[model samples]
Every structure is written in structure tokens, then in C-alpha cells.
Target chain A: MDIDMSLVDWSRAQFALTAMYHWIFVPLTLGMTFMIAIMETIYVRTGKEEWKRITKFWGKLFGINFAIGVATGIILEFEFGTNWSNYSWFVGDIFGAPLAIEGIMAFFMESTFIAIMFFGWNKVSKKFHLTSTWLVAIGANLSALWILVANAWMQSPVGTVFNPDMARNEMVNFWEVLFSPVAINKFLHTISNGYVVSAIFIIGVSAWFLLKKRNIVFAKKSILVAATFGLVTSIFLALTGDGSAYEVAQKQPMKLAAMEGLYDGKTEAGLVVVGALTPGKEAGDDKDAYIFKIEVPKMLSWLGYRSGDAFVPGVNDLVYGNEEQGLISAEEKIERGKVAVQTLTEYKTAKDEGDMETLAQLSPLFDRETSEGQEFYENYFRYFGYGYLNAPGDIIPNVPMVFYSFHIMVGLGFFFILFFFLVLWFTVKNKIDSKKWLLRLSLLTMPLAFIASQAGWIVAEVGRQPWVIQDLMPTVAAVTRLDASAVQLTFVLFAIIFTTLLVAEISIMVKAIKTGPKENEGGK
Target chain B: MNRRNIFARVLFFYVDGFRNLSGWGKKLWIIILLKGIVIFVLMKLLFFPNVLNQNYDTDAERSNHVLETLTKSK
Candidate 1:
């Protein structure tokens, strides 16, 4: 049972590469569908041909994103079976449900109605066509729901039972998995980010049109719609984001600790407003964690636990154990986890050897249905991933990476809220054209939104370091045993393919926007 | 199939719609088609395989192997 460290690294790199590229298209699809649907709704209500033109114009762009998103998304799904087959087998019973539902239900609904939205304009009645458009929006967001639910389950790992005979977690209650607070918050926060991204994208392109003075009426209308949408969703994004962070504190304190670069426990933790980390800082080290910093007093405690004085354990506290805080050291957890592993192995060996008496004795330890078994599971099996760790330091994820990413994401979240408000104000006052600097500044939010979105994911995924399924499994063990070279080759292959596709997409998008929306038939 | 049939009419509607796509629509669609073929058909067939399903034909084998994975020492 020798582990290939290189294989794990390469496999992780490949999956991360595919996911980041796939995401570039997904958020747009998630939010743009709704925006387009709104425009089409307006068209039906007012019999305004211009609104229909706007819908069609955005729909074309949506079609472009939707296609590529499907392509990358398919690769990402298959990577589960390819790179993480073991993890798949472990949680696929639970994870597969949402994913399968996404494909069978949401995806089919989207694909079926998408054609009508595109080509059935004349064939279908206006109301039916509008319904199809709205359905596409709903379908796209629904797809995000199931995928995020699967992701949330990994972060929280609830509502599942360990089947001793099968040696994998199985879903015992679908409702717990679906409506878990973590899942709901993640889904809402993620889709709201999408809405903001779409709003920013539309506003940015529309601003460009205004700057060029090419599509005066079209651009102003677009900005009005997008700015209003952006402002509302940005507020919702912040609320859901708060809930997401609270869940992180409750479920993954280590991640929360890393995100804040906190190395010691604090009863009333101040959230870092901005900070520069001292390089080479590690858990339990005397090195100053931050070289310079600013923080809001007690904000972390309030955000994490909904109280000003709730104790928040940091990296050192979590690793070395905080006795006063009732935190167990990783060293102790590792010992218990090792016992869990060893006993399970002995049970399997005993069963294999037809030793029925030994099996009878060990069976109760693995059974959650019984009281003693529940105790074993809670006290030992819960830390099973720690059994594979070489040292307590292995429990600490890359702190600087998590700390910086979290800061950047929060900074931009506030900025976008302000930016959207100003954009909408300028639009309402009919001063958008006169504010050259503001229009230029508005263009920058699109790229900023992308960075903020990517940073949020970095905090979520990278902060959860070492574990693929929280405490249940470490990523090193979850990765498939494969030749490192094979994974390396595919990584390069995907990089090339995705880059080429992105370049082409940008070029096409630019060309379409420059061409402007199709004029009304015969100029109305 | 009769031209008057609903299915035939629906099929013709899409066929005609796609065939008459404007130049930009047609180009975006071409990229989609090329990407779909490469990602779904070529990439999946060549680069990726379901290791668990490919190697083990039965659930018993999979369960045993996974059980061994969980308990085995590095």
C-alpha cells in the first residue's frame, strides 16, 4: 500500500484545471439565462420589438457559453470516475443522486426548451416562447443546485451512514443531504455570484457600446436592467456569504482558521480587514503570523458563531489542542483513527479466515445502529483520515493561500455593491454618457467579478485542504493510483484545449457585441 | 412520415432553423460542435475510463477492493 505522492499531486492539478475552466462559462450561463428571460418578458408585455432584439442578442451569447460549458462540464463529471474512482465508490451513492438528477431532469429540461427559445420564435406563441425562456433560466440554476449539494455534502458529510461491510458512506436520509444548511447557503451564494457576474458582464459590454456611442438606446436599456439586478443580487450574495462562513466555522474550523491566518484561539476574534502574512509562518511557530494588519474587533467571532465572544480556535490551537476550548489535538485524533483502522482491518481478516467468534466481537464496533457502535464511530471512526497522516502539521492547509484569497474575495464583494449602486444611479439620471471615468471604471468590474468568484472557490476548496470528503477521507488516499506521467499529459492537453476555446470565445463575443443587436425588421 | 404529422413538422422546424442560421450564429455553433466532439467523444474514449467499473464486473469485487483500500496500511 505504497502511496505515489506525485500521482496525487498530478491528479489534483488536472481536476482543478478542468474545474476552473468549466466555471468560466457556468456562472454566466446560470445568471444570463434569467436576465435574458426578463428581457423577453418585457418584450411580451409591451410588444416592444427592441426588447425582443435585446433578448435575442443576449441569447446568442448565452448559446455560445452554454455549449462550451456543457463540453467542459462533461469532462469534469467523468474525472470523478477517472481520477477519483475510490471517492466515487465511497460517496457515489449520495453524490450520484444529485448529479444524476441534474443530468436527467434539469439538463434535459434546459436542452429541450433551449431550441424553442432559439428557433421557435415564430412557430410558438409569445407566451409559450417566454415560458420556455424562463424554464431555461430555471433549468440552468437547477443544474447548479445539485452539483453544489454534492460539494456541500463533502464539506459537511452529514446524513450518511458508514456501511461496515461495504466500507463506504451511504445516504440514509436524502432530505438531510439536500436541505443541509451548508448546501442551501452554498447554492444560494454561488448562484448569486453568477447573477452578479452576468450583470457585470452586461454592464461592461453595454458601457463599451456607450463609450463608442454606437448603440445608444440599446446600451442604456441594458445597463438599467443589469445595474438594478447587480445591486440586488450583490446584497443577497453578501447575506448568503455570511451564512456560508458561519457554516465553515461550525463544520470546518480549520478552514475558518486558515482563512483568517489565526494561529491562536481568541474568545472575541477580530476579522482581518486586510493583512500581509509573514512568509514561512507555520502552525505553532513563534514567527509572527502577520507582518502588518487591520481587523474589525470581534467580527470573526460574530461571523463564525453569531456571537461576539464565542471562542474561535486558530491553526496552533487546533493542531496542539486547546484544552480550555475543548478541542482535541490532532495527535490524539490520529491515535484514535489508527485504532479505528487497525480494528476494521482485523475484523475483515477475521471474517476472511472464517473466524466467526472474532467477527461477532468486532461487528458491534462498526455498527452505528447500536449504542456502543455509535460511540466507536463518534470517538474514533470520525477521525479516520487522520490515521494516514504522518504528523500533526499535515492537518494545517496552506494558510497564506487561504488568507489572501479570502481577503481579496471579501474586498471585491463590497466594491461591487458600491459599483452597482453608482452605475444604476448614473443610468437613472441620464448622466452615464457624461461620466467617462465611471464608464471606464464599470468596465473593470467584469474582470474583478471573475477574480472574486474564483477567489471564493479557492477559499472553499483550498481551505479544506488534505481532505476530499472533510474528515472521512484525505485527498491523497482518494486519488486513483496512476502513472504521474499520464495525468501530466492530460493536464497539458486540457490546458491547450481550454485556452484555445477561451480565446475563440472572447473573439466571437467581441465581434458579436461590436456588431450590435440586430436592428428591428425594416428598422420598424 | 406524413408531412402533416406533428413529429415531422417539429423536426423540419429545427432542421430549417439551423440551416438558415446567420453567419455569426453559424460560427458559434461550429465551435460548439467541434468542442462537443473533442470533449465528449474523443477525450472520453481515449483518456478516461471508469477504473472501478472497468476492472471489477461485480459489486462484491468492488466492495471487497474498497474495503481493502480503507483498512490497508501505507
Candidate 2:
């Protein structure tokens, strides 16, 4: 079959660009919603007039972020049919389940409660409104949870069966898919990251207000709430980041290798803290084509396997080498690789020919040969595919947009940990106002928080290149055969509409923030 | 009761019950919708024995047996 790599690349690029744009507001929506809920809860508990001021102040920002998020998110769903028709068809059986649930369950719940929470402020009692706010927060996070489950299924594919006849994967056991180790870890890690992003967002905005001396009471209270949440979420991010890296090490060694820029497996893999990764003949040569690199201690192994001695596959090993480097016979490795290639080839052929019998027989063969018992063989085969399909060894996750975005996100995360702690310390000493520089810095950090959140999403989505569902279907092969002109038209239309909405949202938010809370507004 | 008084009483009960019961009702509604759509789609698409026979071949017979068991259990 003939393949148009350019079309696939173009479609992927479009999707990645769209998704990155959409995600800029998502984390803020997730984090700010919860923070606003907390403020409202405080208002409910203590009947604090100041707390109510804080809630109303932040809730305005939350509403802006939520509106933008909703507007951007709808484009992504439409693109499934418009851009990725084939992918939608291939994994529609499994993928559609979670998405349908997301729309029917989470989206409706969130949108419904959000309206009640936003508009019912004067009409409803404080307790009822507060409950609605909490539900909105839950609905947003729950939306993330189910989507992650579906995504993690694509990543690890648990509780699913390969229907050789159907030419697709099917959910055989829903529980297994839901409880897959990778999904659970990813769920925690992703939600915690959202928390971090949101907390940083609040802190940044609150800091801005403090610096401006516009709404001192609201700013101080908001920053205090944000800092407390930020500090706790930072801790969770660090821990779950570790867990996620460990899972990646176990499941997707290639991704871990790409992230760390590890070229070869070594006894003590140096963690690249920050450095340029230049493409050249020699590793140490400083040339014009310098790539980013940063080196830390034996943190890679420690993070990957919880032990320094653990061997994590470097990019070079996975991409260039076939042998396991110990105990595995070269002949056996070659034989196993041949069998896998044969199985995959036959499976595809059988699928194409609509020969269910041959397809079914080939499915278990690949599965058995790829499981734990066949690690040595499986590793070599995978390495071979990695080399053949994605060569140059070092050019993986080649999307500069994804790579830099991931780095920026991680960098911002570290920045917030320090920033929040500093704010917390100053607030404790009652010298927050005096530390005007810190306040200014916090204000400046708001856009960075949004950028980081957006970047994190870019990395997650773009890093899983080629596959809409890993190993099952290539993303390019999954796209609908629509004329590029049609997509271009829709893209232009969406861009205009989205831009208008964003401008309006920002204007409204700016006005609300400038207004401050009304004195007799009572508890928010 | 007078018309106004009766109307007020009904409104009070509706609002009171709605505030208290809305949360649980929302959750239940979500669960029902998720299950209903999935079951309906699955039945429409795959429940037909002829479609299964055409699609799965030898596996179709086994799947049919399983489907029978599933329906019996229900």
C-alpha cells in the first residue's frame, strides 16, 4: 500500500497545534475551580467577609479560563471526525467509549453545575452555590480522569483484546483497562500536574494584584490559598513525577530515553538537568548544531528503577543495537526478531484480506513473544523496529515544539516550588507587602504558568507520535482523506472565532479583577 | 389553603428537595447515560448473530455462546 507521510505529518502537526492551544486554559480551569471552591468553602465555614471577596475575585478568572477551555476543547472533538476519521474508526470501539462518557457524563455535569454556580450566585443560598462550585471542580477533574484512562489504554493496552477479524482492538475487560497500573499512575501524575499548573496560575495572578496594590486584601488571601495548595501539589508533583518516570521506564523506555537524552545504557545514567544535545559524530564536540543538554547525578537510574544500579536503555541502544548485551544469543535474537516481523506482516495481510482465522492465530503469537518471559527477544525486536522505522537514533520526539514545551513546563514547576515557598515565608512574617519584588515576580509568572501547562500537554500528545493508538495504527494512516484546503478553511474559521472569544473573555476578566469585590457581597 | 399559599408551599418543597437531591441525582443520571449508550450501541452493532458470524468466523460461535450466557444472566 502506498502511504503519504506528508499528509500524516500535516495532520499530526495540525492536531498538536490545536491541542496545545486548547490546553493553555485547561489546567487553570482545573486548578482555579478548586481554589475558588476552597475560598467559597472558607466563606461558608467562617462567614469571613474577606474570604468571600477572595472567592468572587478568583471566580471571575475561573469563569474566563473555563469559557476559553470549553471553546477550545470543542474544536478537538470535531477534529476527530474531520481530521482523524481513520483513527476514529480504528479505535472507535474502545476510544469512543471513554470520550462518549466524557461528553455525556463529565461535560454535561460540569457545564450544568458551572452555569448554576456562576449565575445562581444571587438566586441560590451560599451553601447551595458552594456545593455547585465543588461539583464543577469535581466534574472537571473527573473529565480528566476518564480521558486519561482512555489515553493510558492506548499507551499500555490492558483488558483489551485484538480482534484480528475486526481489524481493531476491543475492550474485553473494562475493569482491567480502568485499573491498569500505568493508567492509575498517569491519572495521579496528570491531575497533580494540573493542580500544580492551576496553583501557579492563582499565585501568579494574586502576586500581580499585590504588586499593583490594587486589591491587597483579595491578593493576600488568594496568594495564601494558592501558596498552600501550590506547596502541597508541588510535593505531589515531585512524588508522582517519580512514579510516572518509573512507569515510563517500565513501559515506554524509548520515551524515557528521549526525555533524558540518554544515548547508551550505562551503569550510572547521568540525569540531564539542562544541556544542549548537539547532533554530531562525537558526543563532547561543541559545534554550531548544538542541542539542549543538562546533566545531573545518577538520578536517572534512581528515578527509573528506584535503584542506581538499574540499567535503563539509552536512545542509542534502543535505536541502534539489537543484542541485550548479556546472556542473550545473537542467533536467538535474530530468530525471535524474524518471528515478530513475520507475525506482524501476516497479521496485517490477514487483516487486509479479511481472513479472520489467520489473523486470530497471529495475534497471540505476537503477544506471547512480547510478554515478560520473552523480554530478551522482545527488546531486540523492538529495538530493531525503532531503528528501522525511526532512524538517526537521536531524532525522536523530534517536535521541537513538544520538546521545548516539556522542558519549559518542568522548569516552571521548579520555579513555582521556590516561588510559593518564598511567598508562604513572607506571608508568615507579615512582610508580604514589603517584599514588593517577589510580588512583582509572582505577577510576571502567571503567563509562564499558562505556557508551562500548554507545553506539558504538547509533550504528552506529540511525544506519542506516529500512533493514534500505539502500535495499533499510525496517526497518518488514521486521518480522513479530506482535501487540505477544507481543513485549512475550518482552521481559519476556528482561529477567528476562538480569538474573538478569548479577547472578550480577557476583557471581562480584567474588568472583574479591576472592580474588586463589593463590600456587602457577603461570603462568596 | 389559599391559592397563593398553596403555590408557595409547593415551590418551597421543590426547591428544598432539588437542592438536597440534585447531587445524587446528577451522579445517577450520568451512570445511567453511560451504561445505556454503551449497551445500546453494543447491542445494535454486535448483538446480531449473523453479523457476528460474518465478522468473527470460528470465534463467532464462541462469542455467541458467551452472549447467550450474558443475556441469560441478565
User: Whose lDDT is greatest here?
Assistant: 1
lDDT (Cα, 0-100) at A157 in candidate 2: 67
User: What digit string (tens of lDDT, one per residue) describes model 1 on residues A277-332?
Assistant: 99998777788889999999999999999999999999988899988889999999
Q: Tell me the lDDT of model 2 at B19.
A: 65
lDDT over C-alpha atoms for residue A416 of model 1? 94
Candidate 1 achieves a global lDDT of: 0.88
- Locate the minimum summed-lDDT window of 10 residues in model 2 chain A: A383-392
Q: Which runs of model 2 end up more than 4 angstroms from their true locations?
A: A279-294, A325-395, A399-403, B1-74
In model 2, the Cα lDDT at residue A89 comes to: 44
Give DockQ per model, in order: 0.63, 0.04
- Docking quality (DockQ) of candidate 1: 0.63
Per residue, candidate 2 scores C-alpha lDDT tens digits across A109-194 of 76468767755665678898899899988888888877789888777766765443343457778889888888888888778777
For model 2, the local distance difference test gives: 0.64
Off by over 4 Å in 1: A521-524, B1-4
Roughly what TM-score does model 1 have, to 2 decimal places?
0.97
